[model samples]
Target: MATIQFRLRSKANKNVSIKVRLSIDRNNVFELNTGFSINPKDWSETNNLPKQTTPENKLLSSDLKKLDSYIIENLNTDLGKSILIDSNWLESKINDCFSRVVKTDTSLLINHIQHIIDNANTRKVKNKIGLSASTIKNYTLFRNIISEYQKKIKKQIQFIEITKPFVDKFTNWLINTKNYSTNYAGKQLEILKTVCIDAEKNEIQVAPYSKIIQHFRESEKDRYIQTLSFEELELILNVDLSNIEQLNQFKKENPELTKNLSITPESLNNVRNWILLGCEIGQRGGDLLEITRENIRYNGKNYYIDLIQQKTNKSVTIGIIAPHVIDIVENNLPKKIPHQKLNEYAKVICKLAGIVEVVKGTKLNTETNRKELGNYPKYELIASHCFRRSFASNYYKKIPTPILINITGHSKESLFLTYINKREDKDANADLFMQFYEKLNKDKEPQLKIIKSGTND
Candidate 1:
C-alpha cells in the first residue's frame, strides 16, 4: 500500500514531497518511485478537449481530472524555503481540486468543505481566527443550499457551472426556499464567490467564476434600527451596584466575609464609573483601558484629553469636562487591575444590574420582550457598544459643533451621522421654534403696550 507523508528536510523549499513508491520485489526494491509531472500536457486528456459542452465550452470530466494532476504537481514544487509539505499549501491544493469542478460539479464544493473540516479535526491549522473556520461554516451553509436544490429538482446536478438562469433560481431559492432575507442571501452569495475564486485560479484559461452570481446579490448597508429610550438609558445609568461590588471587594479584603457575603463599595463605584465614562466618551473599551493620567493635558485656561484613537489611527483631542466626569476621573478610577480580571468583573457589574439582551427579530420581540427590553437591556445584557452609542447620543443633545467633535474625538460628519437619531433632530428643531416664538412675542409686547394705553383712554 502506498502512503503519503510530508518531507520537510529544508527550511526554504516549498516542494511538498508527493512520493510515489512501488516495490516490485519484497526486499524493498523500489522499481518505480516518482513525483508529479510539472508539465500540464502530461496530464491533459486529448479525448476530452474537442467535444466542448454547453455555453461555457467546458472541458469534459476527463479533462478536468487531468487538470487536477497539474495543480497537484505545482503544489508539490520546491519553490519556497523548505522541502516540507506545508499544511496550508495542501489546503490550497485541495481548494484547487474543487476549482476545477466548480463549474462542473457543485457537489465537489461540498467535498472541499468536508476536507476543510477534516483538516481541522486533523489539527492541520487549528486556529479559530484563521480564514478556514469562517469559510468552512459558510460553505457548510452553502452545501445545505445545494442539497435542497437537488431535492427540489429531484435529480442530482452533474455540473457546478451556474448559468444566468441558475443565478435567477439561486436568488429565488435564497429568498423563498431558504427563507433568507436579501442581506443574508447576499452573504451566502459572497461565500460562493470566494469558493469560486479559489477554483477559477486553477483553470488553464481562468474565467471570472464570480460573474455567475454577482447579479443576484444586494448591496449591504448598515440598517441598524435598534436604540434605547431615555427612560431606559437613565435606568441603566442608575443600576444598583451597591451590594455587588461590596461582595467583590470583601472577597479580597475579608475572604471570611466572602464565605457569608462580601462585595465592596469601591468595586461597585469602579463598575459605575467605568460604565459612565464609556457613555461619556463614546470610546471603545480597548481605547478606554489605555486612557491614563498622561492623556490629560492643560494649555493655560483649558483642560484637554488627547490620544490616538486605536481603532482609527486618527488623532483625537477633547476639551470641556463636566464636574461629574471630573469627579469620576479623580476619585472613582481604581489602580489598574489585570485586563483579564477587569473584563470578568465588568460582567459581574452587568449581571448585578440585571441587564439582558433581547435579540433582534420575531423570537426576541415576542418571547424575550418582557425580560430583555426596557432597563434590563442596558445594565447587564448590553455589550460595550451601548456606552459609545449612548455617549454619542447624549452629547448631541447638550453640545454643538466643535464641542461635540472635541469631546468624542470624531472629525467626520459622516461618522457622527451614524450616531445621530430622529429624536436629536426633533429636539433641536423644537427648541429652535420655542426660542423663535419667545423672541417674536417679546418684540411685539412693547408695541402692544402703547396701543393698550391709547385704547384705555
Candidate 2:
C-alpha cells in the first residue's frame, strides 16, 4: 500500500514549485519537485492541493491525480520491489510518468547502428567519403546480430549497460553460440565498440568499460592460408577445351560435374583464360573482373594492365611479361563473368585439372552458415581471391619485393609477406653475393702475387 500527494513547501505570493511526496510504509518515504508551479493563492491549504474552483486549478488537479494513479500502479508491479525508495529514484519515476527524458526505441543500441547505416553515405573515413559497400554490409549484419541477441536475452540493450560483463557475454554468444570464427567475432566486437565510441561523440552516455572491451582474434599463423601453386595453375592452363564435341561427351559422362561447373564448352575456354590472366596479374576479384580491353596499354616494349584499384583508389600498372600471357592478352582477353560464377568455375577447373590433394583449410558450410575448418580437397577451397594469393606466393623472391608490392598494390612489405605467408629467402641473392666476392678476390690475387715477389727479390 502507498500514498502520493502534491504540496507547496513555502506559502508565498509569487508562484511556487509543486513537490510530490510518496510514502510506501511507516519507515519508507520519498519526495521530489514535480516541476509544476502555481501561486499559493491558487492552492488550497485546507485540502493540501490546488482548489478546483478555477479551470486552470481543475486541469492541474486532474494531472496530479493521474500522476498519483501512475505511481501507485507502478508500485504494485514486480519491478517495484527492486527499486530503491529515494528522492533521485522518485524524480526518475516522476519524469518517466510525465514522459520526460526516458529511453525511446530509437535510443537503444540496435537503433544506434541503424542511425549509422542511414547516415553512412554522409560519413567519411580516411581520404574516402562515406563507408564502403562492404563496411555497410558488415554493419548491417552486426545490427541484425545485435537485434537477435536482444530478442534472445529479452532485454533492450542500453548504451549505459554496455559494460565489461555485457561485452564478455556478447562475445561468448557471438563465438560459441553463433558459431562465428574468432576473427569474425572479433570484427563484430570491433563494430560494437565503434558504434559505442561513435555514440559518445553524439553526447550519449556509454559505460566506461566499452572502450576497453577486447576484440579477440586468432593469429595469422593459426589461420589457414590458402593459395594455388604455380604447377596447379599450369595444369589448369593446359586442360584442353579445344573441341566442343569432346566437352559435350565429357559432360554427358559426368552430368553432376558439368552441372556444378555450370560449364558450356565456349565458356570453359573463357573462364580458363580469365583464371590465367587473374593469376598472372595479382589483383582482387572485383578489380580483376572489371578489367576491360581498354585497360590494356602497350608502352613500346611491354603491354601493361593499368587501372586504379577500387579498394585503395590508387593507380597501378602490372606488366604482362610472360610471353603466353602477353599473347593471350593481345589476341584474346576472356569475356567477363559474374564474380560468384567465376569462383564456382575456378573450383571446377582446378578439380578437373587434378588439384584434389587434401589440405587443411576453411570452407563455408551452407547448413551451418559458417566457414568450418577441416581437411578438404585443394580445389574445394579455391575462390577468385586464390588467383591473387597464388600470384603473390609464386612470384615471391623471384621478382624484386618492391616491384611485387607495387603490382599487388600492397601498402606495406610486412602486409604483403603475411598475404603470401613467406619469409625473405635470399638463397639466390646469397649465391650472387658469393660470386661478386669471389671476383673481387680474383682481381686482387695477381696484384698480391706481384707485390710478394717484388718484396722477396
Candidate 3:
C-alpha cells in the first residue's frame, strides 16, 4: 500500500514551494514537485488545505484532492499492481496525470511523431550504437515534409482527428504537390506508420490508420531488377585494362570515350577486380566493398569469405570457388573501393567492354529529374546491385535452393526467385511436372491398348 500527502519547502518570500510526498510500505519514500507555490498564511497544516476562501484556493484544494484520489485509484489497477511501487513509477504516473489534467492535447499527431523521432535518435541498438545516421536523416526529412503539409492545409491535426481520408490526402500531397515518386511517397507513409506504432506502444493516442497505410505499399513496377548474364559477366572480366599502351591507343581511336577512360590503369584494374569479386560472391555494395584480408578464412583446402551482412546484420560465409574470385582474394585481399565510385567505374568498364546490347530497363533522366523506362544499352543500366542480381540469376538452378538461400541470406524462395527474375519456361515447367508424374506412376505398370481404325476395318 502507498500514501500521498502534500508538503512545503522553506519560504523564500511570502510563498513557499509545494510538493507531494509519497511513501510505500512505510519504508520507501520520495517527493514529487507539484510546481506550485502558496502563501504560508493561507495553508492549513491541520487539514492539509488552503485556508483562503477565494476561488483560486478552492480550485487548488480541489485539484490536490483529485490528484491524490487519482493516484490511489491507479495503485489499485492491474498495471499498478504489476509494477513495483517506486520513484520511477510514481514519476511516470505523475506525468500521466499532468498530461491528462494540464495538456489534454499533448498526443497530437505531429507532436507525438516528433517525440518518437527524438526518442529514436537517442536510442541505442546493437553494440551501443545509436540509430543509423541515414535513418536519423530520413526521420528529419519526414518531419519536414509533414510540417509542410500541415502549413499548406493551414490546419493542425490531433491524433484522434486523423482518418483514412487524411492519409489519402497526405499521400496525394506528397505525390502531386511535392513531386515525389510513388515509391518515395510510399516510403514516407511507411515511416509515419512506424512512428504511429511506436506512439501506440508508449500509450499515446493514435487513430487506426494502418489499413489506409497498407494501400500505399511500394509498387513492384517502380523497381528495376536488372542483372548481368553469363556472357556479359565474361565480357566484363575479359576487358584487358592491364596494357596501358593498348588502352591509350583505344582511347585515341575513340576520342569521345577518352573522358570516361581517364582513370589510371591501376585504378581501373582495382574497380574491375572488385566487380568480379562482387559478381562471384553476390554481396551488396556495402558488404562487398568492405571485405578485407581479415574477412578471408582458409580451411587448408578451400577459402571462404565470412562477414556480417550490413543490412540484415546476419552473419554469412560464402565459399570462394571461381578462379577469378580466388585470384582476387589471393592478390587483392585488402582492396578498398568507394561504393559510389565503383558503380560509376563499373558502368564505364562495361561500356569499354562493348556490352552495349540494348535492353528494356529503367534509367534516370537527369535533365528531367525522373526515371524513364525504355530500351537502354546494357552498360547504361550497370550498377553494383547488378552484380548481386547477376550472381543470384546465374547460379540459381545450378545450386541447391536451401544452400543458395543460406549464401544469399534470403528467407523465402519466392523472394529469392523474384530477385533473380526467374520464370517457368516450357522445358522447366515440363521438367517440374515430369518428376511428380514419374513418381506417381513408378509403382503402376504400363497400360497401353491397341485400337482398330475405321479404315482398317
Tell me the tens digit of each residue's lDDT in model 2 across 76-145: 7635578665676677778888776556665589988999999988887877687766778989999999
Which candidate would rank higher by TM-score, 2 or 3?
A: 2
lDDT of 1 by residue, 77-167 (tens): 6444455444444444545655633233424555544444555434322332324444456667777776777688776543254555666
Best candidate (score: lDDT)? 2
TM-score of each: 0.43, 0.71, 0.64
Judge candidate 2 against the unseen true structure and give its global Cα lDDT, from 0 to 1. 0.83
On the 0 to 100 scale, the lDDT of residue 154 in model 2 is 97
lDDT of each: 0.51, 0.83, 0.76
Candidate 3 clashes between residue pairs 3 or more apart in a chain or in different chains: none
For residues 340-406, could you state the per-residue lDDT of candidate 3 as single tens digits?
A: 7788778778887889889888777777687677998888788898988888888876665667778
Which candidate has the top score in TM-score? 2
How do all the candidates rank in terms of lDDT, highest first? 2, 3, 1
| Clash number for each model | 25, 0, 0
The better-scoring model by TM-score among 1 and 3 is: 3
